[model samples]
Target: MRQTSIKRLYLMEVGSMPEYQIPVVCYLVQTRDGKNILIDTGLPETIPQEEADFENGQDVIQQLSRIGLTPDNIDTVISTHYDIDHAGRHGAFTRAKYVVQQVHHEDALSGNPRYAALRAEWDQPMERIQLVQGDMELFPGLQLLETSGHVPGHQSVLLELPETGKVLLTVDAVPFAEGFTRDAPLNDHNPDPEQARKSTLKLLDLVEHGQVNLVIFGHERAQWDGLKKLPEFYG
Candidate 1:
């Protein structure tokens, strides 16, 4: 559970005209125990063909390769929730075991149209799949915090990096920094608004305690005002 390093890979950009980069980043963490863990996989390559505007697909794979790692290099993948953009490309990591919230898995398998895209990509013969009920530690320093709101069983990862301190990876739990700290009800993708608010408050508590310095959003760029980049390790 000792800290190591975190890497960000840009997957896509969302918006128009003066568009903002809607990055579908995956955090690669090297633990003190020598484990290469991936937080999330960006959109699949077929996604662009399904929806021309979205730019992800193979780029995520390419990004990983550029850093001298391939999908196979990933040993574990923690999906924050079941969403097309977040979990669509999970199939790429065929050899890596996937850890997801059980509630979210059921919701995705319920055949609901809202999760149709998610099902399409995840409905495969996955050899290694671990379904978690709630918050649990994947390793010594990395823990999964259930923040169900954006989606049922939605979760966030808490990394107790030896060098970087604590970092909360809010995958859609708080899509932006403002949403991470404020009581805003505008970012819930799920049908439950109250749950969304509760999740926001839960994350705000962590921020208040200074347990988290880096809050990584699911689709937005990482906050850089006080954080360092690759080749730079914070302690």
Candidate 2:
């Protein structure tokens, strides 16, 4: 199998927000060579003011254990953006090199107001982050699609799965199925709604052109229920 020979994808639900119980999830991607890469992360602790909380059962370590993985097993961590719910758990993957856009790193380090309460979670040592510009190929068949405007440096992941064909992890680029199909970005988190709308259209184009086989949205609880979970993976 090649570097992207139908990787095993695992969804780890780390935590969730209150009321709606919007889940905070992280994805684990294992290439054919057994390289483990993580995508996004849940909150490190919790933000009461923001109404963020972790269920006792949603421990990151425990979630990894479900698939027989440890923090040390991850080789890289990818951040879709600097949002607290998506990137705040950077501290969990202690040994993995973090892969994020250069602009995000700068904004995050400067303590952007969007991440003010979550700033402390971005304390990974400088050496751990590998910053890139624009779109980047992380592996032979894995690509990072920079679809900013939810935040200036946001991105999404795309992979050529052997069986599933093209798998697109929409991340925050499209928060849910409705947003993708309707090109509607939730008002609250879209730093620039105009850009957000355009970026989402790019993703839809991929699907319209029959380039994507599956799409996993960032925090779509409804969609999450219909998809396979850890231990039950897609290749």
Candidate 3:
């Protein structure tokens, strides 16, 4: 298998309400084979007005288009969980194959409100989805690691960078850098706090063992201290 570099794009910044600036970042992992795999899609453009109070004035898709990439260019999409803010704009990547954990699919289909909201995003595009059971290799150097806890099927992607070593694309499993360092219990958004903790510990082990050099969060600020932009690659 060949190695690849990961690039991130700041699609939108949300949660500037009541005094906070939380970014809704979308990652674009370009493979050695030149396929543009999108990690997540930000909030939909037509979010309900009632929900507008928490929204930041930014158009995620438009931002992507400005960088010369459109929804049609995406080939595969991996959703870390079923949160509205994370997976809201899934419809934009209509041409890509949707990937999610099988456990998450069952939970979401069970009518749980949290997962129910995600239905509108994936339900209509069932034909394009590929429900994975556990850890599996998606491409040459890209592997999906099951990191449940934040959500039933919350998972992270591992990319083997030739020069940079390993990089973990951690989603909500650890929302921010502090969460990874402190191993603190996240907010109530996570259904299984204990499981989340376990997942965090597992990540710590990966870091401690030098298996992964960088950990990128779904909603965090920086990708790392130093890394190339989404369109550029290292090694």
- Provide the lDDT at 208 for model 1: 86
lDDT for each of the candidates?
A: 0.67, 0.78, 0.70
User: Higher TM-score: candidate 1 or 2?
Assistant: 2
Residue 195 error for model 2, in Å?
Answer: 0.7
* Model 1: per-residue Cα lDDT over 1-235, one tens digit each: 3443433222222221114655555566765545667777666666544555566533556656655778888888888776666776777888888898889888888876666866655655545878898888878667888998778899888877665577787777777776765647555355777888888888888788765766666655545323443333444
> How well is each residue in 59-152 modelled by candidate 3, as lDDT tens digits?
4566557568788988888887777667877877889998989998778888877756556786745789899988888876677878998888
Each prediction's TM-score versus the true structure = 0.82, 0.90, 0.83
Q: What is the per-residue lDDT of model 2 for residues 1-235, given as tens digits with 9 covering 90 to 100? A: 2346447888777777556756678888888888888888766565545543544237666778887888889888988876767776677788899898898789877867877676666657889889899888988888888898788889999888777778899988887677876536345657788888878888898788856878989888888878888778887
Segments in model 1 whose C-alpha atoms lie over 4 Å from true places: 1-21, 48-50, 124-127, 186-189, 221-235
Worst 10 residues of 2 by lDDT: 48-57
TM-score of 2: 0.90
Q: Scored by Cα lDDT, where does model 1 land?
A: 0.67
Candidate closest to the true structure, highest TM-score: 2
Q: Candidate 2: where is the Cα deviation over 4 Å?
A: 1-6, 53-57, 182-189
Q: Please say which candidate is ahead in lDDT: 2 or 3.
A: 2
